[model samples]
Target: MAQGNERKSKLLGSGDIVVSFEFFPPKTEKMEETLWSSISRLAPLRPEFVSVTYGAGGSTRERTHATVTRLLRETDLKPAAHLTCVDASKEEVDAVARAYWDAGVRHIVALRGDPAQGAGTKYEPHPGGYTNAADLVAGLKKIANFEISVAGYPETHPESPSVEADIENLKAKVDAGADRIITQFGFDNAHFLRYLERARAAGIWVPISPGIVPIHNFKQVSGFAKRAGATVPSWLARRFEGLEDDPATTHLVAAAAATEQVMDLVDEGIKKFHFYTLNRADLVYAICHLLGLRSARTDASANAA
Candidate 1:
C-alpha cells in the first residue's frame, strides 16, 4: 500500500493540553467592546493565561495596562502583559514593570521590540534602555520575581545573520532568567520541530510554546508573517487561494489547516500552545473544541462574579 493511503491511529482524543492566548490593546471604544466580547467568549475554555500586546515604541503602554488591569479585576483569566525594550530608558521601563507588579500582574512577555519605524527597519538599542531582551529580562528579574516569557524565532529572526546566532540570542534570554519562550507564529510544522531539537541540543530546556495563529484573514496574516520573519508555506497558501471573495469558505479552510497543524504537533508530544488570537473567538473556540477541550462551569462562574 502507498504510504499516503496507510491508516494511522487516532490523534484527536487527547484532552491533555495547556493553552494560552495573545490579544492586542484596543484603540477605540468600539474596539474595546469587541475585545471584551471575544474575551468573554473564550474565557470558558480556561486558557492557561491570556496575553495583551504592547504597541511599537511602547506606544500603547497605557492601553495595555488598562486591558490587563481589567482582566485581573473582572475575570478568572491570568493576564500576561507584553513589555518591550523600545525607545525608553531603563528607569522608564523599570517603572512600568513595577506598576505591573503592584497591579497584581505577574507574567510578562518580554521582547526587544521592532524598530520604531516598524518591522523590517533597523533596530538600534536605546542608549539608556536595557540594551536588548536578554538585558531586559535580567533587569525585570531584579525588579520583581515576575514570571517572564521571551520570544523565540524558529526560522531565525530577520536581523540575525544566521539561525545559529538566533539560537544563541535565545539562550542569552533563557540564561537571563526568562521562564518560558513563545515562538513567532509559523505555518510550517517541520521548522518548529527542528527548532525544538536544536534548542534542546543547545541546552535551553525551558518550555517553548509553539505560537499558533488561526487564519482570521489569510492575506493580512501572510503580511504579518513576512514582517516577523516567519514562513508562509506555499502549500498553506494554496489552501487559501481562490477563497478571497468567499469568506465563509476561507474560514472553513482556515479551521481545517489549523486543526491539522495542532493534531500533528500533538502526535509529536507537544502539549503546550500559545495562540495569537487577534481578538476573535468563534474560530479559536471551535478549534479548541475539536481538540477535546470543553468549557468549565467554574470559569464562567468566576466571570459572572
Candidate 2:
C-alpha cells in the first residue's frame, strides 16, 4: 500500500505490472510510419494487449480491420478490435464481430459510439443497430467468447441523462458479459476513485482500468476532454499553458503530468492502467517505465526492432 511518492524508487525497477495501449487507425502514409515507429518503441514492453479504435459510425472500419489484422499477422502483440453500435445494424455489427473472431482476434472493445456528429451531439441510435454498449456486449458474447471491454465514464458521459443512469448502463454492460471496464480519461484521481466506488455499489466486480491520456497536445486534448465530458482540472491547464510552441518542453511536461496522474491513482489502490497513446510511444513508454514495466527480453526487443 505504498503511496505513489513512496513507490517512486520502485518505478521501472521491475516488469510485472499489466498495461494496455490504445491506437487509432492511421489515415495516411506518413501517419502510418509514425504509428509503426511508436509500436516498435512500445512493443518491447509487452503490453497486455493493444486496441485499435473504430471511428464514429464505423468511419474507420476498413482501416481498423487492416491495422488489427496486421498486428495479428506481423506483430506478437495481442490486438483488440474496437466495435461500436452507431451507423450499422445489428447484423452488420455481428458480421464485423465474426470477422474479428475469424481473424484470430479474441478481444473486443465494445462501445456505443458517439453520435455520428461526434461526442456532445445528440445521440440517436440507428433504427436496427444495437442501442448501447450493453446490447453490443451481449451481441459480441453470442458471436464468440470474446474478452470484451466496455467504456466507463468516471466523470459521466456527456450525453448520459444522469450519473445514476450512467452507472446503471455500465452495470448492464457488465451483466451482459463485459470482462473489463476502461474509463474515459480523467485528470482527477478522486473522480476515478469515486466512480469505482459507485460501480462497486452497483454490483460490478470487474477490473476498472483508469484511462490515462498523456498530454501530448494539451490544447487539442483539453478540447476533446470537454466534449467527452471529462473534466480537465485547472491545475492541469496551468501545466501546459505556455508551452504551445515548445514541443520538447511540452513532452517533458506531458511526462510529468501523466506520471503524477498515474502515481496518484496508484496511491488510491488502482493496479491496472490503460493508456491512450495517441500513436506516440515515448511518453507512454516513460510512464510505464515509471510504473515498473520493462522490455521482456533480448529476443522480444530484437524482434520489435
Candidate 3:
C-alpha cells in the first residue's frame, strides 16, 4: 500500500473527490467553543455537507437544533440534521422535521436510532411513532423533498438477525426513497468493498459513502467499535502499541493510519467519503490536504492580499 502513494497523488490531482463530515453537538459552553473552532477550521475545505448527530432517544434534540441552525445562519456550508425514530410519537418527529424545513435545511440523515436505555438493549419503537428507518424516510418524504441518507453496516448490525436480513432492511429504506447510504465506520477496507458489492448485487443503486474515523484515541475507539459491532483488525491495534502515554506520537500515527486507509480507498476508485470527525479537525484537515484538497478560500485570500 505504501508504494501506491505516487498513484494516489496522481489520482488526487485529477480533482474528483467529494467529502462530507459528521459532528456531535456539544454539551457545554467550553465544548461548544471547541466545536465551532473545529468547524471554522474545516469549513474552508468546502465539504459537500456537514451533518450533526442526534443523541440517543432524542436527548440532544434542542442542542442539535441549535448547532444546525447556527451553521445555517453563520456559515456557507450546507448542514444536514440527523433525525431519529426513537422515543417520540410520529407527530412529534414530524414537527421536528417541519421545523428543520422551515429553517432552510433541506437534507436529513434519517435513522432508527439506538435504544434510549443503551446500545445492547432491545429497541422498542414508540407507540404511534414511525416503526423504523424506512418508515421514517417515507414520513419525511411526505413532509417535503429532502435529500435523505440512511445508515449501512458493512459488518451486519448487532441487532439484525443475519446479514441477509440487514441487506433486506437496507433495501426497504431505499424503496422508501432514501437518496444515499453512509456506512458505519470501519477499519478494514476489504469489508467495505465486499459490502458495496453485496449492496449493488441486491439492486441498491444509490451512492454509498464509506465512513472513516481517524482514531484520536485508540482505546476509546475500540470500545465504540465493540458496541457498534465493527471489527478492529489486530494489525490496527499493533500500530498504536506503546503510544498510549504519548499524545504527540499518537497523533502522528493516527494521521498516517487514516491517510493510508483513505488513499487505499482512492486507489480502488472510491471518490466519495464521510468522516466521523469526533468534533476535531486537525487529522481530517491533514488527510484532506494529502488527498490534494486545498482550501479555495485560502488561495483566494493569498491572491487578494
Best by lDDT: 3
Q: TM-scores for all candidates?
A: 0.93, 0.94, 0.96
lDDT of 3 by residue, 74-138 (tens): 99999999999999999999999999999999999999998889855899999999999999999
Q: Count the backbone clashes (under 3 Å) in each candidate.
A: 0, 1, 0
In candidate 1, position 144 carries an lDDT of 95
For each candidate, what is the lDDT?
0.90, 0.90, 0.93
- Runs in model 3 lying further than 4 Å from the true structure: 1-9, 301-305
lDDT of 1 by residue, 146-192 (tens): 99999999999889999899999999999999999999999999999
- Candidate 2 per-residue C-alpha lDDT over 1-305 given as tens digits, one digit per residue, 9 for 90 to 100: 47544764354345546889999999999999999999889998888899999999899999999999999999999999999999899999999999999999999999999767865477788899998899999989988899999999999988779999999999999999999999999898889999999999999999999999998999899988988788888988898888999999999999998988887676656778999999999999999888887676755666888
Q: Where does model 1 exceed 4 Å of error?
A: 1-15, 298-305
In candidate 2, residue 22 scores what lDDT? Answer: 98
Which predicted model would earn the best TM-score?
Answer: 3
Prediction 1 TM-score vs. true: 0.93
TM-score preference between candidates 1 and 3, better one = 3
| Model 3, position 229: C-alpha lDDT score | 93
